[model samples]
Target: MSDAISAASLLMAVVAILYGAWYQEIMHAIKITVPKHDKQINFMVVHNVLVSRCLPLTIMAAIVFLVFLPDVIEILQHALSVLGEMGVKSYRKYDSVRTAFCLVVFVSFIIAMHLCRLTRALMEVRRKLK
Candidate 1:
């Protein structure tokens, strides 16, 4: 079960990196750089370096979330046991609890990220409107 979670997490990380690299601010950061003299090949700084940092910030947010996993697991385990007591014998299995926990955490993380992005975008749009 842990192996599956780890595999899925790894796959998600790879996909996130690929997707985020091309995503709004990161893509702009990669393409735009401080202008260097055309005649001389000089080093150029990123145009908006903060935009590039968003990827690392997002990854860090995910890592920070790992701290809560154990608590979530505990709650899920309890819920599973309770469900079993309530006559839902199918959820009583140890593996079932772990799998359900993984699914819940994965979905929660995805939702949180999307909501954050949506909020940031709305704020940006509001600022532009001002």
Candidate 2:
């Protein structure tokens, strides 16, 4: 699982680099970067760039969650059992992993929803171009 995640991470890194190089073309096609900026930060452009850049990481995290869900569940059960016995002290044992898992799941969901919105926007742009 760790190997798979590592490989995915590497692949995402390469893809992100490539995407960074070519993203302006995509933005042009989707018209997201129109009304160009000049020494000023446009919130919408910033949001889109951030979203696009983070997409690779979010996708890798989501894939990790899907692939390791069973293991995560088993670990979570063990953590809970420890919690029951040791009360609050057990939190220290698994807090980082637990928190990371929760955060990945949450951020993945948000990114997925945002991707849906982006898809709709792309489709709209495509329609306009036609």
Candidate 3:
């Protein structure tokens, strides 16, 4: 189960990086010297910035989850065990870590969905402009 979770997390990170790079390249290729209306140009810039920020953050979050969370949780569980025998205290500590892990996972999923939507929107706009 841990192996599967690790694999999935790694895959998600890679996909996020690839999508970000592809989107950036596509946006860059769309640069044409038409007399830019401020509004349209501003919209494009803002969209690009938002996508850039979100993609990297999403990727980073996934990497942290994949590489750090498991080990950290294990260490934490061990530390908590010293405080008391393996019962309520240990379970509570583990539960806290689990909750944090879940939150990170949920956020990553949301960001992934948003990135997908943003990519689609960008592609559509690029098509229309062309």
Q: Write the per-residue lDDT of candidate 1 for residues 9-120, one digit (tens) a residue.
A: 5555654664565456544433443343341221122223334354445555465346447756776777677776766565544466466546756654774486357436
Q: What lDDT score is found at residue 40 in candidate 1?
A: 23
The Cα local distance difference test for each model comes to 0.51, 0.53, 0.55
lDDT of 2 by residue, 48-122 (tens): 544564354445445644655565566678878998999988756765645555455444445445544545665
**Model 3: lowest-lDDT 10 consecutive positions:** 29-38
Off by over 4 Å in 3: 29-104
The C-alpha TM-scores of every prediction are 0.37, 0.48, 0.39
Tell me how far the alpha carbon of residue 6 in candidate 3 is from the true structure, in angstroms, after superposition: 0.8
> Best by lDDT, which number?
3
**Global fold similarity of model 1 (TM-score):** 0.37
Pitting candidate 1 against candidate 3, the one with the higher lDDT is: 3
CA RMSD for every model?
Answer: 10.5, 8.2, 9.2
Task: By lDDT, rank the candidates, best first.
Answer: 3, 2, 1
Error of 3 at 113 (Å): 2.1
